[model samples]
Target: MAENMTGDIISDHRERMLNLKKYYPFFRLIDTSFSNFKDGKYEILDMGYIVMAVLRFFIEENNFKEKDVTYPEYLDFLRLILKRDFGLDLNEQDSKEIADYIFDKIKNDGRPFEFSYFDPVDRKKRVSRMKIIESSIRDNTVWYSISPDAIEFYLDTKEIKDESRISVSQLLLEKMINSQNFRGGVEVVERINEEVNRLKLKKNEVLTILSGDVFAGIEAYEEFVKTGMKWFDDEEKLFKKNRDLIAKSIEKLNASGSTGEGYYRTMNEIYSLETQLKQAMNRHSELLKDCTEMQKMTDDAVRRAKLGRLRSHMDFTSALSDMIKRDNADILVTMLSPLLKPNIRKTFDLISIDDALMVKPPRYEEKELISNERPEDIEFEDEIEEKRIKDNYVFLMKNLIVCLKKSDIITLGQFADAMKRAYGEQILRNADFFSFFVNLCQKDEYQLGGDAGEDTFLDAYLGEGFKDTESFTFAIRKGLGGQVILSDNCMMADVELVRKEAHGE
Candidate 1:
């Protein structure tokens, strides 16, 4: 079966090569040791070479460093390279076996030949067997084996060797378990448990609220009831009728004041009546709200549950892709950058060219100079109060200074230009003014403009002063509040710069 599969792969490659030759008549095929035919079919003499080529292409394309490579790394590398470079899609099992075969050859060839130095031992002769073992120990080629004699000989010879032999199965298992691609299965299980518990707790709370077994505070409710009864008793007709009865009760209470029994009886009656009135008034309000809230919560929970499985699957796949591409910075840059159009090859410098598309021109609101309230013939000596405060300009200048102090940008010149473009001319006078502030804020020791000292023109126009700089610094700090602050800074700086530098200034 394996031989037949190998023949099929060779035949496929030959057909592909022929198709390529039809399209490009000048195409040439390179000859290698493995490119040989036997029994009317190509023999796969150098499967290891083919596997290595695929692995190398993946590593280079993905920017995978040499140190990050592992057993499963070679497997994924083979899968991607086969699909991407040769347009060959391999299933999981085929990819794994291919990777295993490559690694096995590398391991075998890396060590010296085991049978080269020692003669075969005769088991019947104990002395000869012992001699053979000793001889094998002396030959380093025997280090690859996991046999008891090999292990004992290695331990006796070397002080730093591991006591246990590392098997291929153990290494492969460890690689799979530790790999970022497969490890997230544990996290998915944990999140599922958490979500389940949360749903259960919410359900219990809703059921409790739906039931009308709630108790009010005993003392406060009783006092409130007594006050309501007292209000009723104060009415003229009611009070007149109850006056004699009330006096009799007061007299009875006074006579039994020392006993304390009658006083407790009177207080209990008042509290009971008050509780009845309050309960009837607020009967359904609490229960209705609770049921409505519970229904809303149930709807939300159902929606989340419906999406949970799909979301989890998406999360796992995204995480796997991220893990595979973690070390491949160049590939990520290529994937993310919009500059990679069709067959165009993007260099490092050209990666950020798309940012130019983000630039937008400024807009201004025009107000009429004359109001409708004044007649066309009416003329008055109205003086316009020009309240010109330099605070905004000063603030921007100070900001530029702060950017310089942090060494985030070498010069404020470029930052000033970005600010002018983002905000418009009403705020920043022009690039010259922006450059002046940057130069004022920048250290004298640094050069004007080389790779080492690139200028930030936007920072210069905003302000080169310490306070403004500090504000900008604080705005860029990480977290929730920092985002708002940064946004405000950008808007204010952009707008003011545009307002001031509206002309070519």
Candidate 2:
């Protein structure tokens, strides 16, 4: 015979099943408690409730300082609970015997509750063992507390929630630290990190949905905000509080001036626990930062989807029909301005001066006047050209700000379409649209709130105090691959304008 070793047919079958199998022993232990064929099928009624109550008591006791929960105290508590709830009245000797019997079953007769499971990862059967409650001997008195595994098992018996996991894990880590269970603290922090990473992936999924459908994405995002993001601040405070507690614990341990295997081992576990907590905190912070970015991404996507996308744009079909009806093709120049050409210039040099002298010059071209007084300010053709470029830059920035106001993200292809619809198709013929973008890209990000800096061309609106723009902050970058067809003469690489999200937003 050969072995058939294919992976999970349903993917995660092994993981989910393994998790479920971990609870099997606990359920069976409760069901078969003190039941024996030799004794003619004796069983404890309400054994499940009693077991759960016992676990809760152990956890709550451990949370307090030196509660010293002992076996005799346990017997007394059990006696009271049994009499109150189960209506069982027994003598002191009978109570002790019943307590010992329950204790033996819970402790698996001084052995761990063990089970074997198939480890898909290792392709082998492995044994997992755990104690529902653990005991410690102090001054010849045994102290009992709930184990971390048992606490987690208790939590799993309820509904599975996303945010509850992180919050509950933090509380568990705190409990583990309080009980000096540093090794358990490491596992708790790891679980916290996994939850944070899961949220990060969820953020990306929401953004992807946002890109395609605004209404649906907004609904999903609102739900996400309610569930996970709402508790981010509170969770961060908990992280800091726990970190400080761990630091103080390490200091206290070192101050005890102890030296031995137990002391050093505890010291090493404390340091390891601190390192895991720090990593978890850093991961949590990164998730928060990513979430802030997602807020901007979602807001812009919704607004753009609502306002930027149009149902009607330039009707080139009707315009072309009219052009043909008028029996003139020159109208094609304005209508087909998407493929406009650059201006061609010709000048006469010294070699062509003789030929140029043969042509007559125009007479009386508005009779130039010579003034004796120098003008307050003189602007030449060069100065006029510079002014025109500046004015075009300002105008382009105003429209760019308009897009920025509507949305934080706009691609060049999208902006070009907007300009063609609002300003007219001829605007694309001007070189200034692309030129302004070039200057903006060179200047990088422009902050709109502050006073105008040296990069006056792109940031000029700052000094101008443009209304509705002061709230905006912009960054320009090379866009995802594509080309913006400016004209038949040239094509520009697509650019993306991103409004940078303010910190703490």
What is candidate 2's CA lDDT for residue 140?
A: 35
List model 1 lDDT by residue over 20-126, tens digit each. 32212111111323233334132333453453363334323322121333445556766766567656566787656555654454343223112211212221311
Off by over 4 Å in 2: 1-25, 33-129, 134-145, 155-160, 259-265, 305-505
Clashing pairs in 2: none
The RMSD (Cα, Å) of candidate 1 is 42.0
Per-candidate local distance difference test: 0.35, 0.74
lDDT (tens digit, per residue) of candidate 2 on 1-505: 1232243433455666656655765786767644562262335456677777776666556642426478877898889887888777888977777778777777776456766767666577766566676777565356787666777886676533566667667767887888799987997888787788678778878887888889989998998998899989879878987898898898889899999898999999999999988888987887798889989988888778768667577788897798789988897677567667655666655425533643547776587788898678655444576567777877787788878778778999899999999989788877677667766777667766445465754566334545444555787777568998876665788888887773322
Give candidate 1 misplaced runs (Cα > 4 Å): 1-66, 109-505
Error of 1 at 349 (Å): 36
Name the weakest run of 10 consecutive residues (lDDT summed) in model 1. Answer: 126-135
What lDDT does candidate 1 reach at residue 339? Answer: 62
